[model samples]
Target: MNPHNARIEHHPVLGTLPPRKTIRFRFDEMIYEAKEGETVAAALLANGVRTLRLQEEKGTPRGFYCNIGHCFECRVTVNGKQGTRACLTLVEDMMEVISGKPFSSPLKKGGNHA
Candidate 1:
């Protein structure tokens, strides 16, 4: 099962899982399908997208770490807003999820573009 292009077919304990309603969303200009109500981070991981963003100073790759909202490691740009936490934000149809780089800059706050 290549997660990069398809959804999970089966799980060890859960067995074969039923397909959920899928929605279309964009990641950096490429369109991807994700289950409705799933977090951006979850969807990304499902699609084998680990690196959500990169660190500013060092340009280190960043991906989903905590899976929860605490760490903020899974930050991405939704629409035009910056610093959007992928783990906390649910997937929406037609939503533009940009793989923002450096996560957040020390210079900006409140809005996207950092």
Candidate 2:
């Protein structure tokens, strides 16, 4: 599927939507287009990007389970800020989002527990 044309033009509840302002943002170093009012998760999902991040220890792939802010499964890095929830954050033009980075535990193995 073409990522550029991956938006839902019509909704069953909302009906046809008027054209929204298009903005550009970067995800994992790739540029993508999103509507002005779209959230980071919405924009990424519309572009066919399902895998948002990797599990901290297992490295398992993770995506948006609960679209609402309740579940933090959609957390990602935005503009150098770590642990930013994509589902709640709005997408801004020229915004940079990074995901799927290798996990590094704060406490080292056999380290002292102060």
Give the Cα lDDT of each candidate. 0.81, 0.91
Report model 2's TM-score to 2 decimal places.
Answer: 0.85
What local lDDT does model 1 show for residue 86?
94
Please provide, for model 1 over 28-99, each residue's C-alpha lDDT reduced to its tens digit, 9 standing for 90 to 100.
887778888788888888887879988875688988788988897877889899899999999999899987
How many residue pairs clash in model 2? 0
Q: How do all models score by TM-score?
A: 0.76, 0.85
C-alpha RMSD of each candidate structure in angstroms: 6.6, 3.3
State residue 44's C-alpha deviation in candidate 1, in Å.
Answer: 0.9
Question: lDDT of candidate 1 vs native?
Answer: 0.81
